[model samples]
Every structure is written in C-alpha cells, then in structure tokens.
Target: MNRTFNAASTADDVLDGIDLRGRRILLTGASSGIGIETARALAAHGAHVVGTARDLSNAQAVTAAVLSDAANGGSFELVELDLSSLESVRRCADRIADSGPLFDVVIANAGVMATPAGRTREGFETQFGTNHLGHFVLVNRLASRIADGGRLVVVASASHRSAPFSLDDLNFERTPYEPQLAYARSKTANILFAVEFDRRHRARGVRAAAVHPGTIRTGLGRHMGQEVMEAAIEKLSAALVAEGQAPFQWKSVAQGAATTLWAGLIAAPDEVGGRYCENCHVSEVNDGPLGPFAEGVRSYALDPETARLLWRRSEEMVGETF
Candidate 1:
C-alpha cells in the first residue's frame, strides 16, 4: 500500500476496482455515518455484510436502502447490537457466530464521544465499557469464527492523544471523571486491543489494525453541546495552526470510513498489523505529549507491555476466555 488515499478519500474511492465477491463482513454501528458508507461500498463490491445496530428497525431501513439501490452487488443483513451491555454483546455475538458463515472481516465502528460521567449496566465506565470492553468481548467471542487470513479493524480516534491511559483506574473510580480523557482512554484501549489481538491471532492468519478516522461531523458528537463542540474545535484548530498543520475541518462520512476500509482491505494489509493508522496510512509514531491536532500515533498507545496488560485486564473484566 503506497498510501494512495488521504483523509478526503471516501469508502467507494478506496474500494474502486476492488472485488469482494463472496466475502462476509461484520460491521458495528452500521446504520449511519461511516458505518453506512462502509457497508454501502463493501456491499457494492459484492461482499455480504452483516451490519449491526442498536436498533434492528433502523438497521433494516438502512439495509433496505442499500439493497434497493444496488443494481448489482452483494447484500446486507441486520443484527441487533448494544455495546453498553455484556448480555447484549453475548447475544449478538452468539447469534452471528451460530446463525451463518464465518466472517472475513469485523469492523468495530460504533462508539460514543465526550459523554457525561456514567456507568454501564454492568457498572463499568460507559465509554470504556462500550468503546473498548464491549467490543473486546464481542470480538473475543467471535475470534475463532473469523475465517483464516481474516482481518479486524477497530475505528479509534485522533482524540486519543487527549490523555494517557491509567490501567489502575480505567473506570475513573478514584480520579474525577473527565469526559474528554475518558473518551481518549477508550480510544487508546481500542488501539491496544488491536495490537494484542494481532499478536495473539496472526499465527492463526488473522490480522488486526486500529484506525483514526479524521474529524467528521457525525452523530458521535451529539453528546457534546454546541458550545462545547465549538470550543473544542477552536482549541484543536489553534493547536494545528501553531504546529503549521492544515486547519481542521469536518470530513465526509465516506472519507471517515476510508481508513477503516483501507485497514480491512489494503493489499498485503497483514504487514501493517498492530499499527495505528490515519488517512489510509500507517501514521508516524511520536513520543512525548501529542498536541491536540497532532498527526502521528503516540508511542504510548502502541506500547507492547501495555497492550499485553490491557489484554489480561480485558479478559478479566469481560470474564471470558477466547
């Protein structure tokens, strides 16, 4: 992959001329935004995509739309997935794993951002539970069901640079809960999960990667009020201007899903397993504090030891073994 795509590339742009006939893909948060475009493009390329949404009716609507317009392409099915609940996660995984064929790729794309302090039904921090732990358990339960030479792509965020992860207090149990840091920590966990998953499963011919979709004005930001969103954008824009980087702007949903598409379908993509990617390329690794609008991955997010530790804690938290 010579990095032919950028932050502005759409899902269809990345999938141009690529064939995916007979492939089976499992994609989370598939009803809207990046998820919908990813599903549309991949299905357009002849991949049978099993897309999950918290609500099945909404997913069905999206599926209907995808199918009605596709003159020639693979198809889509809907699954009910609620990432905030382990019971829901288990049910969704079991349904998918038992009801049909093995998945060729799994894209964990649904997530919440900048949410207020709250706990999941299982008593874990909401963001960590949904963004990392929920996906962790879901993927682990389905790990063996992925076809040989399969790929898994976890959609993380550049906001991961906002804070460092604290293993000792992943749930904000002691430290006061900060919404931004909680979201950042969850995004970092997404990366670490990918790192460890690739390390553990590469021998099985399964590769895992994490992606940072560029800033996009998706429903993921509905949690943030207008004032909060404006202030954060201003802050990041100021930092980017200071760093001499291009000014920040919202990318299209298709553009946002392009890196995820790249992660799952790039040529010889296994070579980049365990890497944090943005703009359809393996981002440079930077040490020390990362500015708000920094471009590369923080070395801390890719730390091998931390990845392993996160894996152990994740299994314990999920109370399951792969």
Candidate 2:
C-alpha cells in the first residue's frame, strides 16, 4: 500500500476509495468516541459491521447515524457485551460464533482507562481485567469464526511505554496500587496479545496487530479530574516542544480511529502482523525513556517471549485455553 496518511488523517481518509460491500467486520465499543467513527466509516463504505456494546439501548441511540449514513450495501447491527463479566463475554462470543457469518476482521476496541482502584466481576484488577482479559477470552473463543484471511485489531495505547508487566501481582494484591500504571499494564497486555496471536494464527492467514489511537479527549478520561488532565497535557506539551516536536494536541475522533482502520484493512498483513502500529504505519522498537507523545513502540511491548508468557497467564486467569 502507498503511504499517504499521517496522524491528521481521519478514518474516511484512510479508506477514501476502498469498497467493502462483501466484507464483514466485528467492532466493540461502538457506542462512542473513535469506535463510533470507525463503525460509521466501515458501514459507509459498504461493509457489514456488527458492533458490540454494554447497553443495547444506549448503543442504538448513539449509532443511528451509522445506519442513516450507510452507502451502497453498508449496514450495522448491535450485540450486548460487558467486558468486565466473563459470563457476558462468553454469551456474546458464543452467540456470534453460532451466527454462521464469518468475520473478515475483529476490532477489540472497548476499554476502560484509569479508574479508582477496583476489580472486575472475576476479581482481576479493573484495568487489566476489562481492557485485556475480557477481550482475551472473547477473541480466543471466536478465533475459528474469523475468515481464513482475516485480521484482529486490538486498540492499545502509547501508554504501554510505562507498562512493566508482572506475572506476579497482576491484581495488585502484593504491591501499591496506582491507577495510571494499572492502565499502562493493560495497554501492554493488549500489544502483547496481538504479538502472540499473530504468531499463532498467521500460518493460516489470520493476522493480528495492535494500534495506538493518538490521545483524544473522550469519555475514557471521565475518571480524571479536569485540573489533573490539564496539568498533564501542559507538561506533555512542554516536553514535546523541548524535543522539537509539535506541541501536544488531542486527535479528533476521526483522526484517532484512522490507524485502527488502516492497520485492520489497508496495510498488508505481512507488514503489520505481530507488530505495534500508530499513525497508520508499523512502529519501530524504542526502549528509550517514556514518551507518551513519542512514535516508536517499546521493545517489551512486542517481545515474543513476554507475549507468550502473558498468553499463558491470561488463559489461567480466565479459566480457559485457546
């Protein structure tokens, strides 16, 4: 594929002329933010998009535009899925698995950011459990439902730069709990899950890639106070200016979802499979100091051994094997 997109590109820009009439895609968190734009763009381009949400009523209200704006054969549907509950994940996955239509791509886009310290319905740390473990079970269970030449896109974050995942203390039982660090760990797990998943399924033509949608102001930040957010953004902007990069500014939802669409549908499978992608391209390994505004992926996020280890530990935690 030719390189024409940048951080400023929107989802529509990434798929400007692409036709997806016969394609089928599964997307999570379709009720808000980048997920809404992603579903809109895909369905507008004639793809059959099945979106999952925690509340069917709320999702329906927020996504009327998806149905109203579809062109050609594009369409959208919704299913109930609560990532914090394993039983809910299973029911949703099982229903989709039995529905008979194979998916051309599955985007694990639903997630929680830094929440006050808490646990999931299954007792794992809230961030790790909701953002990582929930998708782990849902995706692995639906593995065979993916088409032979398909894609799995996990929505990770650049915050993985700060994540040093520990096999021990995954639930923060033995150590001090920090909300941001917990979110960082979950983002790392998202990338690592893609790494190992691509390794496992690439032989059969299914490829997985993790994407960092550039920081956007969304409901994802509801837990953070306005003053705290402003201070952090100020500091980040100063750091970027010092490094001679553009001052920090949040991406539009359309811009934020561009990389997810590009990595999932536009980029060659071989180019993006088992990699970390941002700005609509595969990122290089950078083990340097943490830069949330930086471009390169940390070496640990794409480490094969660590990916495998996390896969094993995730399976154990969820009480299922893939």
Candidate 3:
C-alpha cells in the first residue's frame, strides 16, 4: 500500500492543488534549508506559517525571505526556540499556546546530526536530547492545541538503520560513545516517538509520522570536520563510480523537502501512520542485510512494545506527562 516519489520532486510538486488557506502551521528550524523551503511552499499554498529558530535574527531573515516570494501569498511569523534546552522548549510551547489559534500542522524538522559526545541541559546525550526529547516534550505540551485533523511530522534520517536501540546506554554514560551511534539512537527514538504518538493520538484524529529527508547538503553537517566531510564525499563518489552512477547523488534542499511535505499533506492518513518514510515513500522493509543507506528500519525502531516503553521512559526523563 506504500507509494513512492523521487529526489527529482519538489515540495510544490507534492503539494500540487492542495489548498491550505487559513490553516495554521508551525515549522521548527525554519531559518534555512529544507525547513525554510517547506515553509515557503506551504505559505505559497495559503497556509498561515509560524517558523521558529534559535536566533531572532535568523528567524527574521527567514520570515523576510518567505514574504518576499510572490508565490507565498499567506503571512509568516518568527519565534525563538532553542531545542537543546528543556526550559526553552517549555517557554516556546507556552508562547505558542498563549498566542491562541490551534495549529493544523506541526513539523519538528529541526535537528543536529553526528556531533562530538556531549549532553544537554537535562544531562541527556546531545543528539537524543535535542532531536528526540525536545520534540517529545514539545508535542506533549502542544497536544491540547493541535487541531483534530492535525499532523505532527518528525524529520528523521535513514541513518537510524545504522544501529539498533540501546536501552542500557542511551545516554552513553558508561559505554564509549561514538557520535554516529548516538545519532542513530536518536533517529530510532524519532520513529518510536511517532509510532507511539500515533497509537495514542490517532483515535482523536491527530496523526504522526516520521520522515527521512533524503541525504542533502544542509547546516546539519556543521559539526563535522572538513577532513571527515571530504573523506565522506570521496567514499560516496567512489561508490557511485563503482556502480556506474553519478557522483553526489544527494537531492537539492527543495527536493529533500518533498517527503516531509507529502507526509504532512498528501499521503493517505491511514496508509502512513506509525510507518517510516523516505524519498517521498513508505519504505519497503527489506528482509536481509542492507547496503549503506538502503538498510531497512530495525525491529527495535518499529516494535510497538519498544515504542511504548520508550514513550514511558521519555516522559520520566522529561518529567512531563501528556
């Protein structure tokens, strides 16, 4: 029942003919790249957009960019949000909640990729803290105000397939922490969050989905050293050449934003809830070993039991319940 789209498709293409006039949408990390592109496309189709960034200046720049685009006929507003801190999450959610009208869509697209081992304000590992825990608390705080038919989209990564869940060392407190492993754990948590959220909230008509925005160049790579990046690029190029394919197979930012747009607006509601998506499609679960990015979701990421357990654990960690 899963459908497929490709890297060549744009956000506008996925959103074709979809009228969103008057619908209120909130996008995190909207200051640049895919989040900004998605906001522009949504606004162009007439949705009222509230975009959040860590810096007021960056948020304003994004807002100005959206307003300057002729296709974006609807209005755009900016808000301050620092995902690394739970207090910031609370304040940001409180501010949005106080602003009145409910949001029809919430896109948790802000994220940090592989970074050096560290912890958040709450003492959780940085990747898990910012990418998954922040969004978890944000959604729970805003649950009351999310419209009946609203959608919550968590922008995950195919990298989640790189590692299975590690319940014992989720924080890397005892185990030697590898940055990619930490990131993969966080991404797994993203899928688990969506699956459990949908399980709990879908009965009320609100749905949640996790998306893998195809490998695209973005600020998420800011943490990597230049040598690491060059090495990665070289490996990718060699792999492409070995397969007789073009080097730099990643999509443009606009192209990368298509799956998020599709999951947010186009895919059949019943067809997608609780599933993992990439390249604008619900990925088919592969039975055997995977090749690099082609690895299917791990059992831990998809297990309902694990999802529920993680949900409870996350609530305990954040000291907040929905």
Candidate 4:
C-alpha cells in the first residue's frame, strides 16, 4: 500500500491531527518501550486507552505519569494481562469486555524475542505461546466485541523470513528446541494469524494487519545477552552473503512503533487489511535477502490454507472456537 511514513517516523508523527477522542484502544505490553510510546501518542490524541502489563504494580509504577500526558481529557487505565497464561488472557479479556466499550483498535504489540527454550503453562513453546497463541486466544475472545470497522494489529517480525513454521510439531515435542527457530516460527504464526483474521472478519468491518517493528534496542533482549542477540543477527547477515545485502538498521522505541500506528490508525482499512507492513507500508512477500527496506513477508505466513489450518490448530490448543 502507498503510505505517508517511514522508519524515522515517530508515533506522534503518524498520529498528527488524528482526532482519537472517544476511540477505545487496548494495548498489550504497555508498561515499557514501544508499547508505552504507542499508548502515549494515542492518549495524547485523546483516545481512551487500556494498557496491559503482566505485573500490575510494576506497570502502575512505570506508568504513574502516563495519564498526565493525555490531552482533550483522554484517559489511561492499567490492567493485568499475562499473555503467556491462558487463564490470565481470559480474565483480562473478560474484564475488558465488561468495561462497556467495544474496542476501536486492539494492538497486540507485546512479544518476546529469542528467549531460551521454555514452555507456557499449557506446554506450548514460549515464543509461540506468548506471541502467537496467547494473542490468538485473546483476540478470539474479543473478536465479537471489537467495534465494527475496528482494527487488530499484530506486531510480527522480519525474522519470519528466517524459517517456515513446522505445523507437524508446533510444540517442539519432536524437534529439538532452538531459540531462534522457535522465535521465527512464532513470528510466522503472527503473520498467518493476521491474514486469516482479516479473511474471516473483514466482511464484518473488523480488519487485521501484522507489522515488523524494525530492529530496536529494548528490554525484549533482557533474557539473551547482547552477544547472543548479535549472534542471531550474524546468522541473518550470513544468509545475505550470496545476495550481497546489508544488515538491518536499528530504530528508537518511537520509530519502532511507527508501522503499528500507521497500520492501526493512519492507513485506510482496505489498503492494509490482511497485509504485512514494514517501514510503514504494506510489505511485498519477499523472504530472501534483499536491498534496504525491501524485506518481504514469507509466502507461508500469508498462505490462506495454512492460515486456516493454523486457526483450527490454535482453537484446539486454546480449547475454544471463534
């Protein structure tokens, strides 16, 4: 899709003049980094925001000053949501659903990257359970409740290009667990989830889009040391050897959140629904090493058949249907 923003664009830059008053939005991982900035920019524009964090006390401490930033009487509320736990995801969804406002936008911006191997309470891979299936359950719980013409934004990653997800062993029960591979698979699931969500709900006027928040320095790396993260980057850079491509550049928290804001608030619904966005535009499906800012979404992540299959799989995993 043709767009009006880029990597250097901040959340406020994309939100300029956008009157978000009365728009109800739920943002996950809002206690820190890009999530805070995204919540701040929308709140500054007069939107009502419910920001979720795993620890209520910590989130409250980090955001004690958040509500003070809102303009035009916009308000900010903090809620507990541990996406890694299905029970917590359900409780959070229930509380939000009972809050009386159908969300105008749901930003699934919370995620973990390259963490050491582990499983959620449900025994799914850590990255997949938290980043993909958790949000899958949360959104499904809220699907019927989102406002018509609303947006659901999944923050996926360019690492989805690193590997195709293995449907045969989604839990890694058969394959040995590798951190980067698991992370890539989870991210691919993010894109597929968005693609299928759009196909299923666009007719009802609810749209979904996935985004690649450009490489950024954040607490998302707290588990893996900088050297380990760099090792993963080297792996990607080596993949470019035959194609002669450069490594990805980094962005600040504000800039990292630009594409999410662009997809959720700035772009027209039909232009981006069911698409993967990067550098603030609908990205091409390119999974190979390529020129600057031309990184593509993998075909597997956008495959309608795989998306449907994953949908069924996710429903079974969560013990629910949308």
- Strongest candidate by lDDT: 2
Candidate 1, residue 30: the lDDT equals 88
What TM value does model 4 have? 0.93
| Per-model lDDT | 0.87, 0.94, 0.85, 0.88
Of the two candidates 1 and 4, the one with more favorable TM-score, higher being better, is: 1
Between candidates 1 and 4, the one scoring higher on lDDT is: 4
Model 2, 1-322: lDDT tens digits are 4867898999999999999999999999999889999999999999999999999999999999999989989999999999999999999999999995899999999999989999999899999999999999999999999999999999999988876666778899999999999999999999999999999999999999999999899999888888899999999899889989989888999999999999999999999999999999999998877566769898888989999999999999999989
Candidate 1 lDDT over 30-146, as tens digits, reads 898788888888888889889989988767876666676443568888889999999999999998888888999999998998899998889999999999999999999999889
Candidate 3's C-alpha lDDT?
0.85
Error of 3 at 18 (Å): 2.1
Would you estimate the TM-scores of all the predictions? 0.94, 0.97, 0.94, 0.93
Cα lDDT for residue 102, candidate 3: 94
lDDT of 2: 0.94
lDDT of each residue in 1-322, candidate 3, tens digit only: 4445676888878877778887899999988779889888888888888988999885786557676652545778888898999999999999999995999889999989888989999899999999999999988899888899888899998888877786777888889989889999999999999999999999888888889888888878878876888799889889877887777676788898999999888888786788888878787776468765563666677789999999989998999887
Candidate 4 clash pair list: 286-296
User: TM-score winner among the candidates?
Assistant: 2
